[model samples]
Target chain A: MDAIDCDVHCAPDSYEALFPHLSEYWRQYITEAGIRVNGLAHAYPRGVGATAPSTYEALADRVLDRRGVRFVILNCLTGFETHRNAYFGAAVASAINDWVREEFLARDEGLRASLVVSTISPEDAVAEIERVGEDRRFVQVLLPVRSDLPWGHKNNHAVFAAARERGLQVALHAWGRAGKAPTPSGFTTTYLEDYVGNQSIAQGQVLSFVSEGVFERFPDLRVVLIECGFAWLPPLLWRFDKDWKGVWREVPWLGRRPSEYVREHFRATTAPAHLPRDPVLLDQLLEMLDGPGMLTYASDYPHEHGDGLAGLLDRLGEEQRRSVMWSTAAELYGLAGNPAASSRA
Target chain B: MSHVEVRSGGAPVTKRGVELVDCDVHAQATEPMLAQYLSAPARRLLERYGRRTPRVTEWYPRARNAGMRVDAWPGKPGHIWGSDPELMRAQLLDEFGIDYAVLEVLSGQDCYDHPDFAAEWNHAINQWQLEEWLSFDPRLRGTIAVPHEYPALAVAEIERRAGDERFVAVLLPASAAEQLGSPKYWPIYEAAAAYGRPVAFHTGGYVDHRGPGYPSYYLEYHVGNGIVMQSQLASMVAGGMFEAVPGLRVVLTECGVAWAAALQWSLDAAWELMRDDHPRLERRPSEYIREHVWFTTQPIEEPDDPKQLVWAIEQAGIGERLLFATDYPHWDFDSPKQALPRVMDASLRRAILCENALELYGLPRERAVP
Candidate 1:
């Protein structure tokens, strides 16, 4: 069975790579400010070999051809989501979207891209989503996990609404704004804390989405947590379901258990899999998580998380393996007519 | 100690013949009650403000009865839940057959911006707990509430209470202005270790409880408790707090347990990638966690499949480290009789419910049931 990589990261080599896509005003602004895309440098430090493919050809060579995946979704995180200035953020988001389209999606038939949006302003984010979301190749709207407020807040609901209207899923990728504290307490002193914090932050987002009734408002809206570990979900959902039972009146719109909403609406990319090394334990965890239904394959190229994927796959049944490796993501992105079937046709 | 009324008739212990230790039991204190233990200047300040300390704005509205179980409240007018020791003993200790219950008074005084005022408030809370609650019940123990933001003051508070055998742990908020593991707070850890009192990071505090600003509902805030605990655990592991104070033991109370295994795995992965960044004398993150940290199973993670919950516990490899707790008087209190999974091994169940806490708090194995 062919696999579908849900979170293959792509970025411009530098700010200069986006110059062609950017307006002259932003071009000059970026140049003058000496703005460079750090790309989770704190979390995925340079010395640890955390580089992404800067071009489609490079990505194709590195992941597509090597991994033998049927489809790969390109998530372009150019540090635009962290911009403080709304206008600058919007422009950069637009440029990154445009750059991903022309430089990656337009070049590869198998490639689909996530629409980059400015998280600083909901209106701007919605506009960006609406503008670029018309393209069938753009399967999801990409938002950074780190934000001034959670994505489920009513103020930010429009972004999700816009994506839903455009038939685009929202993908919250790990390692968002560096300015925001990784933890609720405050800034983390080391890279390890900041890195592990992605999973923690993802849990908060899941709670926010469920508690704020984001699913109730947009019943069909789906979310994918990319690079955020999936192992934490079962426990988080357990807690969520338990807490919601006591406080369901507060969020009366939630007609069902929070876990039910999550199971129906959410999918997570399996990269940097935080699974137990013991196969028996891993299998038990998978059973608890309903992993086949929730997880999709993602190489998270150039980021080394050891051989967790192999261990995870070895623990799963053939059907469950196929679901995680291909069908789940294929169904999620609505990737109809597999190339294998189409080629024969 | 002042004489307090006791109900001679109380509910029978449910877990008959089983050793039970409750790791978390809040002994609530009202403003006027805490004021009695405060210094003259602090008492005047309390009167001037009409409250013991400035209330930190709780952005999200809590559940009914201010997140307290309605039944746990004393029937008397103006009395709060867990305020009357006799009521708590009837409802929690005697009723549940809890051999030892660690008393934590979450006064929210530690969140006070004024260092001096915060210290005074925490000191008052400690005194009140000792005199009123601890002295009232032989089954009860104390957790020293300190102004954790001010380490020197926190160290002094720990030292002052170090001689008291009743105080089992030093209480710090899970959410704080800085990660509890930061070097700035190492002095507090050192003091806790020196006294052989484990540092317990309980759920609520002054710090924002969600990573992405504040949440919209109390449900979110409640769920964020686990997230905050994960972050603190990671911070402690990465900050080398265990290595800095090798004897220092940490306990995460009222935070969910199942997520710890995943967090440990993620930490181990990240440490492997960024080991060079932290060279403070070496060990895998999970090793340190397994060796040093303990988790209280209150508001325990109840997965649909009971077996799955057991698997999660086993995966965490901290079965011996699990301390059972019933967050008494809270709306979502876990009952000692029904909390642990029936599927869990008898030995592990005993370890979580009684033995682990007995060893951690250095309590006697054979305490007479009151």
Candidate 2:
């Protein structure tokens, strides 16, 4: 019954807590944006959602400990700490990773953090990944899905290259900053536009990266969608395949069908599922997605959303649940490479 | 007696040709004929007082009426359905082999020229809308447009076209004329019920139309505009439109499935709390709504999201009434061929894609596409 949460949001308190103290330049960006995050934006109230290692200990004690959760993959949300000008995004990311290392992963053997990347600039994002690239504590490089543009645009290749070079997973999460999608019906579009952050951009990003042959160029590189609802993925994949037929001849870099690229490279999670725990249905969904192999469970805990231990148990069987709980993620993050699984502490 | 999809495998899982119902297509009037329906005395008085006489040009460009073929039109697809609707039908229906699609008025919805002209415009559009459907666009069907602002005009218009039988349903914004539940608008609903016409309510921003604060691109606009349908549903229920006009079926378009369920629950909850307010209502609000309110899951995004369709059906409690739509010629057009979820049983597909809509609108099934 061991469990692992591949998709979890962790943030920090006042921007200063992560950096402790920042240079004059970074502080100016935060002040100028006039950003006011709504209450309940992240996992915790007093701290960035999971800035403290104790956050993992608490989650283990509350959810995994009882459910036998052995590890939890952490996707930090400090990317939310934004600025109007692009300069500070990288600085904030660098400082936040340092804090995540010192706090959440400092002692929690079960913790695997996805280092946050600033959308503000490509060079800064690459540098931050390089700075923390050597640590086993970080497995994926997180990017917020926020714009209307496709992710394959050559301007983004630098970021994609950095991710490939570092052997890090490119995981896309929607922070609450995506621009709107055009829909005349205007009833809060279900899939791409349904959520607060742009799910459309996330789909577009996934499509862009694959269609551009990011995966084909770097075969070992893997991509994941965290906290992305399951419903939008299938149709979008179909669309990706359908649209690429006439167009990919123009974008010659791609060696295979976009859907084929996704099947070979991509993974998605069933977090924040709209339906309450329905095991029979969830199994069918996993099968459709290519099997339980493609999915790993993450109960966005503390918030009622993750629904704590009960909801996690909803989808688990004696053995299958155990894989998502720890083993599969163990394989994905190259966790088997770590001696930590054997560590008594 | 059936094993659902397996037991009833005869239904079509996919359609050939352009088998569609552009559920919300509109047809506008040509020149003075449309204006002739409005109140001329009111027009003169308003003009005398310096109120701008509303012009048709404001909402429509003359180019829309120009007859152009669908595949032939280049650039933006906005002009695809040009002046000759018969051409649109020929291309989309007869040419592409669309079984049948419903055609509504694209414009001329507001301020009729005179009651008689309103009656005639309503009659002619319904007639033209039907003829347009019946012509080369063999796949087309009529969706009668009503003068939502004037109920008597709407009733007279519905009655006049009632004989043709091509008029599928009476088209009205759930919240048109600002006084929907009031007694003033009951006549039209009554006429629709008498004639077995269902009421189709598409989310019309007859008022405000702005996107969410950060809609930076085309994607954002698609999600932001669909919210108005909720307001339409709310006003329709709060106004007691369903109860006031029993047997008057309603279809809520553009609003996504999740909200419709919420509205159904909220309306029922309100009915319980304020039963005295609606003495005329025979049953709970949700009961009437679930019975009467059908929803079009068109421009349907999140087709892969496993529960989206199921949740919508559960919420409306109208599995038979949830119709499939592509919102063709829009940024997020869903090709029904690819959009139908794998789990959607074959019967549900046929029922949602055409049967329910056809039954509600009284569309001819034989002439749907062939």
Candidate 3:
């Protein structure tokens, strides 16, 4: 069985190219300052083996033509990530969504995209979803994980409503913002820390959404936390239920178990699976996590080393392996057209 | 049909063929038991500041459901610290198949009666942690809790307790009266370092003491996990706790994982800007976190994506630093099996369930059953 690295990510074209198609209002904000997550200082430098920022023709050529792979699900850098100026954050989010619809998805049938949105201003994010969600090609809604608060705050329901209206999954990515920054005793940080930080962000985001009854409101609104990893899954589900029982009076609507909601609505991707190659450890993780379907494989292409190789897909049972590769994501993003199996089987 | 049978061996056996090491199991302290080990001065402080005795009980009535009358919440049975030890043992170690349980006690009420009698009060708490908590059960492991006001005394307390085999680590409120893990609190870490014990920075009470800027409510405190998350994690990283004590290891307990990715990235950015400040450090702030820090995830209520958990580990590159913690007896305790999607594969479970924890705490997997 060949490995199908379904979560492989590649950026397409530069911001300048994507900017032209955005609305005049968005174009103004995007032009004034580059994209940036609110508090995160890191920048999305370039895609792996990138030439010309990231181009669709180049991305498709690399992804579809790979000698030994099933597909690469490209996670586009949120258009709003490059610009730190919060004033234009909303406009840039709209423009990024517009670029995906007009250029990448409109021109090619072989591509999938995570539509970027403005996390600061949920209204603009909702507007962006309304504008781009109509396209069948737009499979996911990508929002920066880097914000003063996790994206699940009740105030952000407008964005959730928009995505739910279009049957689109919310793609949570690692990005940072200002105000209420974690730890004021600023110090030098490292890449490894950034990786773990992403997971922490996802944990907070998932908790906020569940505690706020986000799933209860939009049962169909699946929140796929791509690139955050799966190590925390076991403890998170445990802690939420444990804490919820003690504080259930605070959140009246959390009737069902938190995991039940997660099983129904969330999907996570495994790129650069961090643990060492120990069969025993991996086995226990699967048992603890309960299954591989929730742990999809992503190449995170444009980086020096992609997610995994053909050897990995061959390691699991046929059914389990297929779900991680394509079926799970296909169902998640409501991609009725993709060539994935229909049934959970 | 297959039944899990331990065939006369000393290795853990399970249905999925996996063992677990819970890094953050908690223990409850009884006033009498903890008071026994306290000195005259410490004992008085506990009776005074810890309990704030001669007190009036105020009730904020709440309804369990709609149309119900509001009443003071006594909380669930065994809600704070279940009276039974065997029950805790089975739930934390046996049920989850965990081998080690890093026990953090239920911290007493705070902000009032602090600063003046601080060390004495903390000594009382630490005495209970070591005396009553250490022997709660075979699975229970304990840490020394200290009063943050007296950093030097807190350090001294840690040094005294570090030699005990039962004492696994030291606990500090990431937010007491002041932001924790800051340079101001380096003495606490220094004491931890002297004993080769790790610092378990647990989150609580920051909402009451600090300005979280959120409306008062249970959800606000619980949901705004970042109130402590921001100050503690950020303070540790930015304050160069890692730099101050290169050999020191920091632990984050019951704090959610959502802010970690951004916080770490922001720190790395800050690391560049504040190069002159932390001139003694060899690497970036995130580097110390990757190497020396560990976090516990329980009641993982947020984020539906199981892979994002892995992504987070990868992002932090602290897989070794991650420990599967169940804040048992408290609100967010989790069953190992119930924590993750039942479909997760075996290899991933092994790392999250046991190996990672064993490596993190440097513990031997007891040959209880195979």
lDDT of 2 by residue, B217-306 (tens): 222222333444544444455556776676788776654554454344334533544455446666765676677778777655343355
**Cα RMSD, model 1:** 4.5
Off by over 4 Å in 1: A337-345, B1-18, B50-57, B108-110, B368-370
> How closely does chain A match the true chain A in each prediction, as TM-score?
0.95, 0.78, 0.82
DockQ of 3: 0.06
Candidate 3 lDDT by residue in tens digits, A1-345? 233344445443445665565567665654575643321224333322333225567666666666545434556564534445555666656656666556555655555667777666777778778887776666667876655555666778888888877767787765444333322212214333333455555666677677778899987787877666555565567546655666677778877977777767777776545432445445545655667767665666654323232434545788988677666765665444333532111
Question: Taking the candidates in order, what DockQ does each have?
Answer: 0.72, 0.03, 0.06
- Global CA lDDT of candidate 2, please? 0.55
Worst lDDT window (10 residues) for model 1 chain A? A336-345
Candidate 2 deviant stretches above 4 angstroms: A19-21, A24-67, A148-152, A178-205, A211-213, A238-255, A276-283, A306-319, A337-345, B1-100, B104-319, B322-354, B363-370
Candidate 1 vs. true structure, TM-score: 0.94
Top candidate when judged by lDDT against the true structure: 1
lDDT by residue for model 2 (A260-330), tens: 78766777665644332355544444444555555566665543223323544466576666665666666
Compose the digit string of candidate 3's lDDT tens values, residues B284-303.
Answer: 66677677777776545344
Superposed Cα deviation of residue B67, candidate 3 (Å): 22
Q: iRMS of candidate 1, one decimal?
A: 1.3
